[model samples]
Target: MEFRYLGNSGLKISEITFGNWLTHGSQVENDVAARCVRAALDAGISTFDTADVYANTAAETVLGEALKGERRQSLEIFTKVFGPTGPKGHNDVGLSRKHILESIDGSLTRLQTDYVDLYQAHRYDFQTPLEETMQAFADVVRQGKALYIGVSEWTAEQLRNGHALAKALGFQLISNQPQYSMLWRVIEAEVVPASEELGVSQIVWSPMAQGVLSGKYLPGRPAPEGSRATDEKGGANTIKRWLADEVLSGVQLLKPIADEAGLTMPQLAIAWVLQNKNVASAIMGASRPEQVAGNVAAAGVVLEPGIMNQIDAAIGSLAERDPAQTKSPASREA
Candidate 1:
């Protein structure tokens, strides 16, 4: 696997890293999760991403249990804060100082690790003061509980303000995780440019558009069985957006280009995201081990400039359809 610097930081993460979002704590059992992690490790993917809210905190516990003894030191683990993980208490959520402090201890205990390679704010918390959040993050780094810190789903202005706060307070804001894919070119707006200017690398999630770019779904067809589209936890929004007529048509338009490039739809989809200089890695989420292997193989299939141009042309069509909904990659770029 190819390794890239996370922003300007010395931390090097795999181009194809495994992530435990919904799979680890929910779909897969303990032994299965362990096998998936081992599959990633064996494939030379050293980074594993998780979040406190994933699977109601069971994701971290399973991840910690999988990285036993010597394996712990050899891997890079990342987890996020600022999501609800509770039996219904208001204090159990958000990026407040109390939540950050309480969450980190729980995460550390569950993962059984002394320090996380990177700790990220799951999203911008409107309720919490950015400075207060930054200060707490800095303290975590100073205390050695987390080596690096990042943010996810932040706006361009928020990223700038956060970076300034980190610099003034002597903390490093290294990266941002965001949803980026061929079909969802929203990050190209302000998020990409801002992240580029500030030296924050983008570790994009959902590069496959949550399987829309995987080529399994076709227009006017029933939702595939055993697919996320049919899964209750996959969320209704995904089904509505992905199964929409225009979205499926867009995917259909890209098929010939992928074929010409000698790549599968998902391979072409993932490779397209990596072509951007700002993207450090694409968090490859897989339920089965073979899915992980297939995703890793996509890193090897190079897309020619012509093929890239074809892809750009196809996706550009969507801008005319709904320009107002475009998302800026300012948080993800550079």
Candidate 2:
């Protein structure tokens, strides 16, 4: 597997990271999740990404159990905070010092590890002071709970402020995890540039646009049974926006491109994201072992510049490129 340094940090992560977001605890049973993890490991994926709020904390427990016998020093395990994971208490969420401090212990316990390679803010906490959040992250690093810090889906302005604070406070904010895909170009206009200049690389999520770019959801037909679009308990809701006929038709246009490149649609999608120099890794989620094997082949596959232009043309106006649209919710609720 190809590995890249996460932003300017010394830590190297696999180009394809196995992530458990909707599949680990909600969509798939623990045994199936373990099989998928085994597949990722067999495929040489050393980076695993999860979040405390995923499946209300069960995802981390399952992941920890799955990697029980693996050498911990060889893996780059990452998890995030900022969402409410337990009882609906006011203080059970956000980036407050209290929440971050308490959350790290719970995460470490559930992860079966003493420290995570990276701890990210799942979303910007508008309710907390920026300095308070950065200082709490610095404390997390100082305490050795996490080796580095990252943020997910934060606006460029917020990232700049956070990076500046992290620098002043003596911690490295090395990565940003955003929802990037062949269809979602929101990060390209501003987030990528800001992160590039600030020494932060993007570990993008949803490089397949919630499976839309896989070309499985054909136009003029119902979603395939058990597909993400039909799995309400998993990604159905989030993927609805990409189910329109125009988008599906555009995706269909790329099938020939994949054929020409000898890549599966998913591989094409994943490789397209990796083409960006600022993207350190693309997180992939799977409920089955073969799915893991299929997607990881995109690692180290470089798409010709001409093929990338063809992708843009095929997606046409379906791509969302507005930098302003890259935003987080205004409030953190339990």
lDDT of 1 by residue, 1-334 (tens): 8888999798899988788877787877778888888788888899999998988899999888888774566788999998788673777877788889889988999989989999998888877788899999999999999999999878788889999999988979999998788776666778889999999999999898888888888888877888888777754446467787777877888899988988888888888889888999998888777787778877645678999889878777663223234333322111
Each prediction's Cα RMSD?
3.6, 0.8
Considering only N, C-alpha and C atoms within 3 Å, which residue pairs clash in candidate 2? Answer: none
Tens digits of per-residue lDDT for model 2, 1-334: 9999998889999999999876898888999999999999999999999999999999999999999989999999999999997884889999999999999999999999999999999999899999999999999999999999999999999999999999999999999999999899999989999998999999999999999999999889999998988887857888999999999999999999999999999999999999999999999999888899989999999999889889989998999999988888898862
Q: Where does the lowest 10-residue lDDT sum fall in candidate 1?
A: 325-334
TM-scores for all candidates: the values are: 0.93, 0.99
Off by over 4 Å in 2: none
Model 1 pairs in collision: 186-327, 187-328, 187-329, 190-330, 191-329, 191-330, 191-331, 192-329, 192-330, 278-334
Stretches off by above 4 angstroms in model 1 are 235-237, 319-334
Total clashing pairs for each candidate: 10, 0
Q: Using TM-score, give the best candidate's number.
A: 2
